[model samples]
Target: MAKETYQSLQAQIRKLQEKAETVRLKQRQPIVASILRSMQEYSITLDELKAAQAKGVSGRKRSVGTAKPAAKAPARQVAPKYRHPETGETWTGRGKPPRWLVAAEGAGATRDQFLIAQ
Candidate 1:
């Protein structure tokens, strides 16, 4: 009859979530097995399944393992295009120029003078 504390309520929620997951898996196991059985009986291929999904035949599309969304390729590092002669600061020619480069330009130094030699 006593009111539950915040910690007790949180613990209950965690326990319920675990129980729900177990129940969900248990419930899905039969359905997944039946689907597999049907696929085997009908000789259905993964490609066919993907095609159906692409056509929006039914339900949301799913990708398993190798067919899942591809991880994007890593971005290549850009080489610095300009470097300060005295301080040795570098810039990749992207975005705004650094304070030193701006100051140097303001002081009558040209960008061509700061270009790093190939």
Candidate 2:
């Protein structure tokens, strides 16, 4: 029954973190190798995949860097679900708040105050 000192606990935590990171990298190695193999087999480039991913996420038609569009379009377009009252700013309530919404919150307005009237 030994009591753990702060230094001992900290060292254990660092050791566990390093072990976890090593395990994570080991888990990721097969995926990375598969991606590399696929790129080589299909004659696809990483830049092309990145461009396609960006285009699909933003729902924008990017011309300069993208390859030919896939047979399907993005899943669907998301309509904005929230709007600022005074500034008439809109947000889809998906990822992060827009600057105007953040400012409004800073000014003591609650998030529900910006709900788009349905």
Which candidate number maximizes TM-score?
1
Give per-residue CA lDDT, model 1, range 10-118, as digits (tens): 9999999999999999999999999899999999988998889889786765667668666799998999999999989999999999999999999999999999999
**Per-residue lDDT tens digits of candidate 2, residues 39-84?**
9999998789888887685477666676777787667878999987
Looking at model 1, residue 48 earns an lDDT score of 94
Shift in Å, residue 16, candidate 1 = 0.4
List candidate 2 segments past 4 Å from native. 56-118
Candidate 1: where are CA atoms >4 Å away? Answer: 59-118
TM-score of each: 0.48, 0.44
Q: Report the lDDT of model 1 for residue 70.
A: 67
In model 1, the worst 10-residue window by lDDT is 60-69
